[model samples]
Target chain A: MNLDLRIPMGLLFTLVGLILTLYGAGTNGSPIYASSLGINANLYWGLVLLVFGGSMYILGRRGQRRMEREPQKPADTDSGAARRGH
Target chain B: MIHTELTYVDWIIMLLYFVFVLGIGFALKRFMKTSKDFFQAGRALPAWICGLAFISANLGAQEVIGMGASGAKYGLETAHFYGIGAIPAMIFVGIFMMPFYYGSKARSVPEFLRLRFDEKTRALNACSFAVMTVFSSGISMYAMARLIQALHVFDHLFLVMGWPLGWIFTFSIVLSAIIVLLYIFLGGLTSAIYNEVLQFFLIIAGFLPLVLIGLKSVGGWQGMKTAVASIDPRMLHEWKGIMHPATNPMGIDIIGLAMGLGFVLGSGYWCTDFLVIQTAMASHNMDAARKVPLIAALPKMIFPFLVILPGLLAISIATPHTTTTVSMQGGAIIHETNIVPPEVEQGRGLVPAKVNPVTGKPMLDASGKPLLDYDMATPNMLLHFFPTGILGLGLTALLASFMSGMAGNVTAFNTVFTYDLYQSYIHKNASDKHYLAVGRWATVGGILLSICTAYAAINFNNIMDTLQLVFSFVNAPLFATFLLGMFWKRTTGDGAFIGLISGTLAAVLHHGLSLPLEAHPGIHGGWIHVLHTYPSDMAQNFYTAIWAFSANLIITILVSLMGKPKPEAELVGLVHSLTPKPDTGHATWWRRPEALAVLLVVLLVVLNIFFF
Candidate 1:
């Protein structure tokens, strides 16, 4: 629970975004775009993904910094151990 | 059978997803130190994380594929499943029910029943719920594997490796099962919830573009409406021609839809079903737990656009015939064109007819008309629009949905099995660490059992169908039992147990006596005798749910009158009237549960009106 979920999520999107962006950029104006109605969808969607991925990464890092500044209560972890059975 | 070639980039995107999920599992391993952490994430998740996981848990492959199929068959009215059916019940649960669940401090839903009722009721619920989750996860796996097989996604690789083509089904099933098992086994509920949140975003990222490209192809909303109207104008309206079962695309009137889907099935599944409620219960505080469902309602209300719009586009758009030339390994040239025709028949559209595999001919129904395979709508749209790179992303989105759903069920199953079954009855005095070990083992057992069921599904499709039908019977009347137990303190354990049994029997009896028009008496219903005929199968289903709910409600009241009630002192937090009002904390008015519920209700009304 200590791990900020957005960190992994951000990393994932960033990686996928980078892959698609590069692929889209490389494949620009190729006949492969014909299936997508002559739209360079890989490039456009890649940029959109890159933006989304970047924002999540930034927000996650910010959250991690804030969490480090204020340590969590020990009671938070103890509650789970204490309440073992109904 | 629309098959597309995938580029290596697509494989990398997919492989990266698998790596990230497993990475999350490994990262969270140290945090899962207790049974509580493994089963319930130590009840420490923030509301937003819990909120997205809440809906994502239920957004399995079947939900995506099945909703799209329903959209093609029932058209715009398919939104009723979300608009009327899911939204209200979600709000009701967040505002009214979460306090009892979160405050009572019960570890599981069945445990809550034990606190409020008795041991018998809890045992019944726990056993049935545990079994149901395993089968459902298996069904999800089966459906995904079948879809992969049908799409021939991995056939080229199999062929290149000198493997038989049939190995794709087994390969896909085992690969996905292993992936789901590893993640949940390593990190438990926290991993599942985190992965679900990621899957939610991925689903939007993948499908939003599909909808956009599709709408553009079909000329946007107005254009799609015009095209669909040419086929059947009724398909374009949510409420038009819904006075009678025969008129509407769903074959159910407003009363049936409202009572059966909205009140009965909706509340039963969304409110009481452990799969969704577990996500909310994992919240860090009571206030966040209360807000979980409300926050989920925001995305739940608008999902029709991302999931169902593709079906509309599939049925509406006329994909122009354009040849794509391909060179075979033997140096033979082949040209491929669009499989879905531009002009479509009413109620059929782009969906192809089911074929008899043995005869290699279209399968005929009782009335001699070929049955349509409407499930292809969403997949067809994916193939119709996406090129190679984006197509990989789209397929990965689908794979994400399947794995998320499987993990959700496995987590729910393991929790119930370890806590409600193993600890309660099998080994009451086991240490927390011992129970934690048992929980991990149960996760493996659950996934392995699901794999068996998946193979069972592949061999005997009818058995899976019957199992699903029986599960629905058990589920249909559950909301009534939960409603009475939570609101009325007089509800006794005996009454609940008997009420639930009779309610399931009522569902079976109703289904046995009725049959849908133009259908034979079998899995579709009328096993006992055709005492009644519904206009369509959907109408019969709704009525069956309504009957089951009514029987449970009335019978529970009557049975409770004859039995002694649980003492009121013990029922303080379990019953609604007895529990103290939950504090909304120092959050502003807009952030409070009530305020958010109200906002969601308003949005629901606007959506219904716009679609109406």
Candidate 2:
């Protein structure tokens, strides 16, 4: 399968969000950490994973669109025709 | 509360459950018209049923008993095994792996291997997986039998059969085996799936009451928390406390170990294992197949709440009142705390005498008398805490768990035998009728073998310890081969085959050699000092997996590089299947990319709060 860079990129951001949320939550008790983070750790990490998984999916769809725009190869056209015959 | 002695009604209830399972199998026989229908449920299972079956397949008797033992021993961190170890791996499988397996019109994982690689690879993968399934089935059988005996459901069988108490284990195994076999034989995957769905609902209904009643008996969640705190403050901090050497038997880093196991063994079980993949493979189309994973994820996410929380509650109720006692063996005073209370050590010859401060007599009960037994603590709690009908439900749930797990193994075994082994090697030219007959026989054979294994499993001291050992031994290496195969295109058949064999052997040797040395470091101080102490069996599993996979990957890549690469066209089918398509268009059932992205963010945030 062709690599979808969009999904991987989205996943990277999601992972970062997760790490930040974990950092925030781990320091929930300390006033300094809580004020700086502005969100509890649990919600933060949850949000991060959700976003990461989500973005990859979106990027995957977008990559699919770009690939569709490219000119079809002779081999691809032949296979498509063969499938139609079957 | 029902008496410790199970009444006639309990036996009747148990029998009814068995009959109901068998009945479902027979009832679903109409769906088994074609080989495809029998093996893949005609690729038409609904999302909810598939999801339930997926969860049910994973929830075996071993999990229930093992989780209980861990909760008693390790406090709340034990829940991580269920939550993090199982749930996330399942979610990953659903999200990522499902699309690949289900989208491809493959009958079994071995079939996929055949498509991706060659016949030799398919045969090797199928046989290895079959062996693992048989071994696991045996373990599950033994665990379920032990639970039944504990519940005293086999006293009648002992009398009727003119057998010893040991026969209770036999009876339990035979009963479970026969019931599971009857269904899988008659209905195949369709029967297994429907039964699993029913069993899943029954198990949940059965356990919910136990948790609720247990909490009520313990004076609610806060009271339970206080009880646990009074015993050990560390119990509340699930993560940090889990890291302690005393808490984890193997003494390895918890998160690292769990995630490693998750990546390797978890991927193999959820992603590549035919038993799980078959459920999704039964979907009518690619969209339905895709839906299987996401729909399944919801149940996987929720199961720990039912299975693991009750264990934590059990620990909270039992911990504070726990006591230490001396054993007569070497006049050794074992400082037992949490779960093993003084009241528990009345009988069974484990506990030794301690003089009373005032009475100058053996430490006794309220009447200044000796206690009976320590092992009855969990059982006593069940009888006292849960109400009558609810107790039946709890026991039934436990039994349902066994049925679900066993049925999955049996179905997978039958599929492998019918398609890969029997049809491929034994009777390549056999008719459909002949193959179907053989499939039924294979199911029966699987049950009998598992029963024998279960008998052996019972002799082991603790069920959970045995299960972890079994999983680590097989899954670690199996995971290595599948992971490499899935991603690395250059890996040749010879390399794949050799790597799998070598990785498996290495993992077994490491587990056998390293485990004993770790357990008795005093006897082998030199070895112990050199080899780092691993924490839980899960950690050892991770270490073994890493070593095995590393060895396998290196060998596979090296050998492949030296040999010929697979033709590009050969891999096109697999590659194209995974490639997302634009013009194909999206269905309403498909999660919106933006919404999914948000959910991913939320999941990560939740994980960080708990994990970090």
**lDDT (10s digit) by residue, model 1, range B215-277:** 887788999999888877888888777788878887888888989999998999999999999
Clashing pairs in 1: none
Q: Residue B65 in model 1: shift from native, Å?
A: 0.3
Q: State which candidate has the highest TM-score.
A: 1
Backbone clashes counted, model 2 = 43
DockQ of 2: 0.02
In terms of docking quality, how is candidate 2 classified? incorrect
- Candidate that would win on DockQ: 1
* Chain B, candidate 2: TM-score: 0.82
Residue B576 displacement (Å), model 1 = 1.2
Interface RMSD of each: 6.4, 19.0
DockQ of 1: 0.36
